[model samples]
Each structure stands twice: as C-alpha cells, then as structure tokens.
Target: NAGVTQTPKFRVLKTGQSMTLLCAQDMNHEYMYWYRQDPGMGLRLIHYSVGEGTTAKGEVPDGYNVSRLKKQNFLLGLESAAPSQTSVYFCASSYYLLDTQLRKLFFGSGTQLSVL
Candidate 1:
C-alpha cells in the first residue's frame, strides 16, 4: 500500500507562475501537513489539517495554501510563485492512537520546486 505519495516529484516555474502540489495517503490518517525545507534550515511547517474539511495555517503559510477536501487527499497551492519560494516541499500524515503516546509521521518522498 502506498502510505503517502506526492506528485510532480520535481518542478520548475517562472517567478510569477503558479502550481499545485498533490499529496495522497492510503492510510486513514486524521492529521495531514505540508512542510518546506530550505538549504540551511530544517523543515518548516507551511500548513496543516486535523481532519477532513478542516485546515489551519502553520509557521510559514505566507506564500502557500492548503485544502483537505477529501479524507485521503490534501492539496497545496502556490498562488504567485516567487524565486524565494524555491525549496523542497514535503507532505506528511499521522494518526494519534489512543494507546500510543507518541505519533509517528509518514512522509512522502518530496517535491523539489524551483522558481526562477
């Protein structure tokens, strides 16, 4: 089973072009997230959703938006792409089990995006 998958593993766009990153999960997870990793920085949370039809902004949500229309799918959108937005984007999902104290995150391979 594909736990988590991301489409368009790599992409290149002009400074003002727009694009959407698709994330899919076969696991019935209640929590989903989008994060971006820069050259010298750790992964930064861009947005997250606790459950289907529910979404929230994360640490770095300025240039990005997310939607959780379906329980197994989450979509991240870049409205107006910028050169500064060049980074590797990652999608993750997890479920909080009642018997477990710690949550285990399942991550997608990742999407490399370049805005020039």
Candidate 2:
C-alpha cells in the first residue's frame, strides 16, 4: 500500500524556533500539498506544488514555506516557530486534484505540533 507519509508524527517547539517537516509518497504522484488544520478554521492550504521543481503559495502561505524538488517528496519549513503556528500539519498527495480534473487524495495520519 503506497501512499503519503509524514515524518515525526509529533513535535514541540519553543517560540522563535525552527524545524522542517518531511513528506514522502510512493505513488509517483505529480501533485503534493501542505496544510494546517486549526480548531475552527478547517483545513487551510499552506503551499502546494503541481510537479517537480516548482512550488506555489496557497490560501495561508504566510509564516510557512515549502519546497518540491523531487516528485516524491515535499518539505515544509518553519523558520521561526510561533504559538499560532502550533497546529496539526498534514502531508497529502494525489494523482490529480479532485476539484481540478483528477480526483481522490490520500492523507497521512498527521503531525501534532505544540509551541510555547
């Protein structure tokens, strides 16, 4: 069963800290995404890349960064951690965007993060 997987299922960071979350997939998908789920804000996209060697900001791209150098891997980086940034980070992969022609997505369990 090849699908999306996230590294360090849990993490804790102090204010103004830094960290990098890794996401890998084995489906040879062409699209990858990073999102943060808050208490009531639902799932907001932080960044997404349509294919290798390209990346773009999403609905809530501020305070976060992402890179997609390899088609199978996407990385989310936090330069300075903040309390507000403490939320579940999810790594997702899809052969195609459900809303954009291709459908269905596989999501990893999640990364629970805490910031102080």
Number of the predicted model whose lDDT against the real structure is largest: 1
List residue ranges in candidate 2 displaced over 4 A: 97-100
For model 1, how does the per-residue alpha-carbon lDDT over 69-113 read when each residue is reduced to its tens digit? 999999999999999999999999999988875688999999999
Q: Model 2: per-residue lDDT, tens digit, 1-116?
A: 75898998999999999999999999998988999999988999999989999999999998898889899999999999999998999989888656769556789779999999
Per-candidate TM vs. native?
Answer: 0.96, 0.93
Best by TM-score: 1
Tell me how many residue pairs clash in candidate 2. 0
lDDT of each: 0.95, 0.91
